[model samples]
Target: MTTAYYTHADCKRHEMGSWHPESPERLQAIEDQLIASRINTLLDYREAPAALESDLARVHTADAIYRIRENCPSERSEYDHFPLDADTSLNAYTWRASLRAAGAAVAATDAVIDAEIENAFCAIRPPGHHATSKEAMGFCMFNNVAVAAKHALEVRGLQRVAIVDFDVHHGNGTEEIFNGDQRVLMVSFFQHPYYPYSGTEHPASNMVNVPVPAHSYGNVIRELVSERWLPALEAFKPEMIFISAGFDAHREDDMGQLGLVEADYAWITQQIMRVAKTHSHGRIVSCLEGGYNLSALARSVTAHVKILADLE
Candidate 1:
């Protein structure tokens, strides 16, 4: 039950602003809790490497990659920012950090496939689920999990893969990238009418998108997983599984209206693990996505990692 913990120092150096919710402190908070919970010692630590341009090409368009690289801000005393949108920005360190974020996912995928570890959790920032193939927005630079899924298929020669996104926001970027691709089966439950609101329309047959209303509780998510996600996953029998593991739905977090707690996250992880063990050889790679409230994010991540590590 070895679980690799993938992260990089560059992740903390990428910041939108002092007041932004997606601050660097989010990673530190998870680190503090893992120590407090004594779960840090039970895991294997790995530094995330930089992703190659070819890896980015698998999911992101060349124009998108060129935009991110060319728009990198030069070093300055006051630190300049290139705003991708109203809520997302790119600082000087963003290019390096974005590479690390995507790299962590790819490295974790390789590790799992090679059986270096049963699974891995990527503690990265500049959360990536919202970035589409042609653009970077919603605090995301590149679609990290998508790159990993593609790497698994193209490089590792996997026939099929499953991406499970539990983020509060709909993974419009992920859905957009893998929309008509039959090799990838993406299942997710996101708050409807939410930010980047776009998951409720006619999705591809390979997608199982369950859009729930705001204020939906943990029970609703559990039921959706049982009836929607599990059936598709079982039928697909993915060769590998990737999770856009966002904890913003925690009841204590104000980022979203969904009322999910730590125990609920644990239950969800258990279900994913069950399916992974049965179909995917217990191979899982989870990358960070969203979760604003520091305390809730830390505690929720601890719970989720505990299940992945088989600690509890």
Candidate 2:
């Protein structure tokens, strides 16, 4: 079976502002790199559908959903920003694109569950690791991975699902949604004293949060995963795995100081693949989170997707 690649053009239509780091160009970067690397030829491409309100309600409250929907402007020239905390902004196409981005996760989950594909990667954006159930923050509208995880358990009747977040920033939103849910295991590594800086203290039992120092190298991350993530993941014996795949830790990306290179991302993907192979029957679904610098983001994602597509 081939890996499924899920994306939509409407994802490119969602924009916060001209100067926002989480720009539409991020998706274009990954698409261009995948095409140039000939990696697109290795996978099955699928169009992402817009998520229904019920699907979104699995992770976010109806009121929060209504607020986001109400905030989306009707025209591009019109400006109405609904502040979900401080950083996240809702523009004209934000609601539709957010639905499509979340929909990509649901579609990917469905593909993997039905064995239509062994794995899937969602290359959409306004990344979603930061939006919690009641609020949105850090460039996220709805929690895409959380919604997928919820679907895997509630809809697919899976006993266990694991979410591995390798974003430079903490997946606080995901943790908030799944903190007490025993059916889910979340293992993540992020730079401490960074944006949304709360992962370092009083984390939930189900969360394996490794808050590494800034300027740390890939070796540090590798060691943390080896010591913390693998053991917990093996013990959990998850039936499927989800990845919040973020590449901002790359040395060239100014978003974070962690000195990760492209090979580091490839190595992490290989490690996750091993776990998936051994426990989850190679069932893995990955969604994009954060990566700002165009060149570094594209190159790092190329490396990550090469392994996900089994092209490497």
Candidate 3:
């Protein structure tokens, strides 16, 4: 089995600020670990192509797209920022970076569905799980995985796709976009009462949202995945699997209080792989979501990708 790695140099150019946890260095850190672990050369590497407007339209509203583009600074020297929310902002390169990130998802999906690779992982940033159809929130500009999931079904003709979001925060945007769509099933675990604070309420039937309390541990996630994620994934029998892989739940990342470690990330990845092996014929596409601390993020991502690439 081979894993395809997708990323872009523009992804490193879109910086929110000096203080933002979701910085360009996050991607660099992930790459550093991949090289250190000797996993970088073990798979196919590709520059992520920019996603087409048509693909993005599958999950985002035209108004939102217009507003996002309109908000982009004309040039790097033209402006410092245009805040989307208190957390998200538009720098000069944000628009292109967002497009590349979304495009990376689409590219990964195509590669996997076309059987060119066993699976794929997108290291592009500006995480998407928090972006809703109409608004950008929580450091996300476009719903990357949602666009890919839609592309898988609408363009690639896949009947069913499963999205597994294990970010420390709920994938509220993904749930909202694919809420009642029978073609997709989104399973996730996030800390309750967290940022954007809305997943604990009434969720759609297709959404399997398990809320974790603050200070929880990886064991909690393991039990939940075994009891909640696997059965639903098996029953749905998805033709393709997409993971909203986030490492913020790690013990070393101060982004959340989940207390998970690299081992936990690898464990969950293995479980997801097994499910894909059974139902999706090993077709999987994982996109980076949240991981703050450089060291922990790198280690956690290396662990996750090692299993995905069969380098473990």
Per-residue lDDT value at 107 in model 3 = 92
Q: Which run of 10 residues does model 2 get worst, by summed lDDT?
A: 76-85
Superposed model 1: Cα runs more than 4 Å off: none
After TM-score superposition, the amount by which residue 18's alpha carbon in candidate 3 deviates from its true location, in angstroms, is 0.8
- Tell me the alpha-carbon RMSD of every candidate: 0.8, 1.2, 1.0
Q: Is candidate 1 or candidate 3 better by TM-score?
A: 1
Best by lDDT: 1
The global C-alpha lDDT for each of the candidates, from Candidate 1 onward, is: 0.95, 0.91, 0.91
Query: Could you tell which candidate, 2 or 3, scores higher by TM-score?
Result: 3
User: How would you order the candidates by lDDT, starting with the best?
Assistant: 1, 3, 2
Clashes of each: 0, 0, 0
Model 3: lDDT of residue 299: 95
| Candidate 2 residue lDDT tens string, 1-312 | 588889999899888778889999999988899899987888799999999899999999989899999877777554655556556787778888999999999999998999999999999877999999998889998999999999999999999999999999999999999987899999999999898888888887899999999999989988998899999999999999999999999999899999999999999899899999999999999999999999999999889888987888
Local accuracy of candidate 3 as per-residue lDDT tens digits, 30-135: 9988899887889799999998888889889999898888888878454488988788999988889999999999999998999999999999889999999999
Task: Record all residue pairs in model 2 with backbone atoms less than 3 Å apart, i.e. clashing.
Answer: none
- TM-score sort, best first: 1, 3, 2
Question: Stretches of candidate 3 above 4 Å error?
Answer: 76-79
